[model samples]
Structure formats: C-alpha cells, structure tokens
Target: MKKEYFRYINTLFVVIPMTLIMAFVGLMRNYGFGEDWIIKFLKAWSVMLPVAYFAAFVIIPNARKLAEKITGKS
Candidate 1:
C-alpha cells in the first residue's frame, strides 16, 4: 500500500529466503552439517538479517541507478 509498508514487506520477503539459503550454504561450508548446524545457521541468519536489510534499502537504489546509467536505460 504505502511506500514504507511496502519497503518493510519487500525487505522481509527478500531477506528471509536469502538468509535461509545463504546461511545454510555458508555454515555447511564452514562447519559441515551436524546437529549443531541448525543453531549455527539461525545465529548467522539473525546477525545477517539486519545488515542485509540495511544494504537492501540503502544500497540497492543507488546500485540500480548505476546500472541504468551504464546501460543507458534511464
């Protein structure tokens, strides 16, 4: 509806799946799968979520602008 509401929902939708996938891959890469892997994944996801949210809001718009400029897409 509103821009603010949409921003939050967008962040949630993007971050949740991304964090889940990346965290699983990263933890498994570093520590390997085990009973403790779930805990490690959740902890890493928790830490990453805020940073990812911040970057999505702050960086993505500028990045899109840069891409548009490079492609002359306007």
Candidate 2:
C-alpha cells in the first residue's frame, strides 16, 4: 500500500504537467479565444480541472491494474 501510494504521487507529478503541456499544445492553433469564449473556457475549467486532476492522480496510474483486476487479466 505504501509503495502504491508513492506510485500514485509519482504519477501525479508526471500527469499534471503533461496535461498542462497538452492543453498548451491544443491552444497553439488558436492564440486568442475572444473575450466571451475565453470567459466561457475559464468557467468550464472549474469543472474540467478537477476531472483532469482525478484522471491524472487516480485514473492513469492504476488504470491498467484496475482493468486487469476487473477483467481477470494478468
């Protein structure tokens, strides 16, 4: 459990920045969102950021193991 806990922490270190980088890459094509769109996007980020945090902190690290455990896979 301790090892898994550490692994989860390590996963977040990797995931958070990677997610930010990917978001940046996506916005590269559109340097400007316009005032309204930018506000809308910022508003949406309240919901989106936590979902992303969960995925990075919880989902990604154990995803394979969880899938295998669920599917009776090795």
Each model's total of backbone clashes: 0, 0
Listed in order, each prediction's TM-score against the native is 0.85, 0.45
Question: Per-residue lDDT of 1-74 in model 1, one digit per residue for the tens?
Answer: 87869878977899889988888889988999887887898899999988888888888889999999999999
lDDT of 2: 0.63
The alpha-carbon deviation from the true structure for residue 46 of candidate 1, after best TM-score superposition, in angstroms, is 0.6
In model 2, what lDDT does residue 38 have?
A: 54
Residues forming the 10-long window of minimal summed lDDT in candidate 2: 38-47
Check candidate 1 and list the clashing pairs. Answer: none
Instruction: List candidate 1 stretches off by more than 4 Å.
Output: 1-3
lDDT of 2 by residue, 5-71 (tens): 8865776676667666555555545654655655554555445556776777566658878888999
